[model samples]
Target: MIRAYAALEKGGELKPFEYDPKPLGSEDVEIDVEYCGICHSDLSMLHNDWGMTQYPFVPGHEVVGKIADVGSAVKKLQVGQRVGLGWYSRSCMTCEWCMSGNHNLCATAEGTIVGRYGGFADKVRAHEAWVAPLPDAMQPVSAGPLFCGGITVFNPIVQFDVKPTDRVGVIGIGGLGHMALRFLHAWGCDVSAFSSSADKEPEAREMGANHFINSRDPNALKSVEGSFDLILSTVNADLDWSTYIACLRPKGRLHFVGVVPNPISTEIFPLIMAQRSISGSPLGSPATVTQMLDFATRHQIEPIIETFSFDQVNEALEHLRSGKARYRIVLKH
Candidate 1:
């Protein structure tokens, strides 16, 4: 039986729960979770925000753990090896997308918390393909966010072939944005951070932003028109996206890693006239996750995280909901 904390109803408090897992598959592995990160998506699932959450939900995908058990056919991972799991727990290995090495795009991909118990537990299980081994130099405590937030931002850089000398802009210096600034800066881009909060400027620069633009100021927004080669938005809130589109240079791209609640309303003429593009991506494939971990370790980039004991899960969720978490929250087992 696996012991976990689960919400028995929509928006209910998580309580102690236990259940015997199904017989482990020949291609699966069981992880002894050491720490897990709380993501906004977890909160969204807790309240059935996307309307796909199930009752007795356990909300955690950013998992850092060690292999406690492995299926007979699992060849790449060994028992006691450190690993991490992200938003996806499994994907149909025979799908065209998976065959093309884009498993994250597989139509049959399984979310860690969509209909299954997740890392808010003593143990979690996933197929070997979705489990990524951790880099030796990477610290496991703060490495949880990299599996989700870090990969969300990093995938675009690789997919788009962001040039090292190109100018890049990051909107919202929070969880995803902060990691973007660090990665882009280390990647040798001229990094700009856009935020409504003026106070975040200092920290943003310290994290590798070459410039800080007050997103709330019209003039500041205007001054950077036609400036960026790429703009990565990491905030979930909807904004005057046209304004951001106007800031892009010809052939530049505006990408999204955040989940904006409303459908985007924008003019098509600007994109046509400037040859610009607007796009978004989900979390990366396992291969890309490996690359991201290696890059993070080499650059010494890690999320700014606040730690909590597993029993303080409720308080940590509330802190995240209250918007007081410095950047990311990690619950230790």
Candidate 2:
């Protein structure tokens, strides 16, 4: 039996719950969760904001744990091996995207919490392919968010083929943006940070941003026109996107990793004239995550995080809801 905190209904408080899972499949592994990160996606799912959440939901996707059990066919991961799991727990191994090493793009990929119990528990299970082993140099307690937020931001750099010499801009100096600033800087790009908050300028710079643009100021936005090779928007809030579109150089791209609830509205002319493009991506494939983890280990880059005991999960959730988390929150068991 697995013991976990679960919401009995939509918008309900999480309470103690337990269940016996079916026998593990041949390719499955059970993880003894050591730490789990609280993501905005967890909050969204808690309230059924996406309208796809199931009741008795255990909402955690950013997981770091040691393998407690593995099925007969598991090979790469063994019991007692440390690992991390992200938003996705499984994908059909036979799909074209999976075959091409783009399993995150698999149409039938299974979300960690979509219709299943997740990692807010004593133990959780996932297919072997989605479980990424943590490099020995990485700290397990703070590595959970890297599986999700870290990968979400890092995948774009790889997928878009962002170059070391390119000028890159990151919007919103929060969870994903902070990591973007660090990664882009380490990648040797001239990195800029765009934030509505003036207070974030110093922190953004500290995180490796070479320039800071006050996103709230029109003139500040105008000054950098046609300057960036790529601008990664990591904020969910809607802003003057048309202006952002204009900030792009010819053939530049404006990519989104944030989950903005409303429809994006921007003039098509700017994009048409400049050959600029707007795109968005979910978390990276497992292979991409491995690369990201390796890079982070090599660069000694880690998310700015605050920790809480698993017993205080509700308080941790409230901290994240209040927007007071230093950047990311981790729950230690």
Candidate 3:
């Protein structure tokens, strides 16, 4: 039986729970979770924010752990190997997207928490393909977020062929945005940060932003018109997207990694005349995740985090819900 903390009902506090897992599939592996990161998505699921969360929900996806068991068909990973798991647990390996190395786009991709118990536990199982090996240089204590938030931001840079010489802008200096700034800066881009918080200005610069644009300042937003080759919006809050669109250079792109609850509205003339584009994506593919790990290791990029014991799961959830996390939260066993 796997021991875990679970929310028995929607918006409920987590409590100790246990259950016997199904027979492990030939391609599956079980991880003895050492640490897990608390993502906003976990809080969202805890409250059934997406209306797809299951009862007795075990909400954690950014998992860093050692392999405890492996199935007969699993080849790349071995028992006792350190690895990490992210938002996805499984995907239809034969689909076109998966065959083309974009498994994150697989039509039947399984979310780690949608209908399954997740990593806020003593053990969690996933198809080996979705598990990423941790580099020796990456510290397990702070590596949990790399599997989710880190990869979410890193994938766009790889997918879009963001150039080192490109001018890049990042919105929101929270979890995803902070990492995006660091990655873009290390990639050699001229980085700008768009934030409404005055206190975050210095913090943004420390995170690698060369310019700070106050989102609330019309002059600040207007000064950068046609300035960016790419702008990555990492906030879930709705903003004046049209204004962001205007800030993009000709043939530029405004990409989203955040899940805004409302539809984004923008004028067509700005997009048509400038040849600008608006796009969004899920997490990265397995190959991309590996690349991200290697790049992060090479550049020494790590998420700023606060730690909590697994026993303090509810408190950690509340802290995240309160929006008080410095950048990320990790739960250790």
- Residue-level lDDT of model 1, residues 1-333, one tens digit each, is 999999999999999999899999999999999999999999999999999999889889999999999999999999999999999999998989999999999999999998899999999999999999998899999999998999999999999999999999999998899999999999999999999999999999999999999999999999999999999999999999999999999999999999999999999999999999999999999999999999999999999999999999999999999999889999998
Question: Best lDDT goes to which candidate?
Answer: 1
In model 3, the runs with Cα more than 4 Å from the true position are none
Task: Please list the C-alpha lDDT of all candidates, in the order they appear.
Answer: 0.96, 0.95, 0.95
Model 1 CA lDDT for position 23: 96
RMSD of 3: 0.7
In model 3, state the lDDT of residue 58: 92
Superposed model 1: Cα runs more than 4 Å off: none
Estimate candidate 2's RMSD in Å: 0.7
C-alpha RMSD of each candidate structure in angstroms: 0.6, 0.7, 0.7
How many clashing pairs in candidate 2?
0
Query: Candidate 2, after superposition: displacement of residue 144 in Å?
Result: 0.1
Taking all chains together, each candidate's TM-score versus the true structure is: 0.99, 0.99, 0.99
- Error (Å) of candidate 2 at residue 102 is 0.7
Residue 158: error of model 2 in Å?
0.3
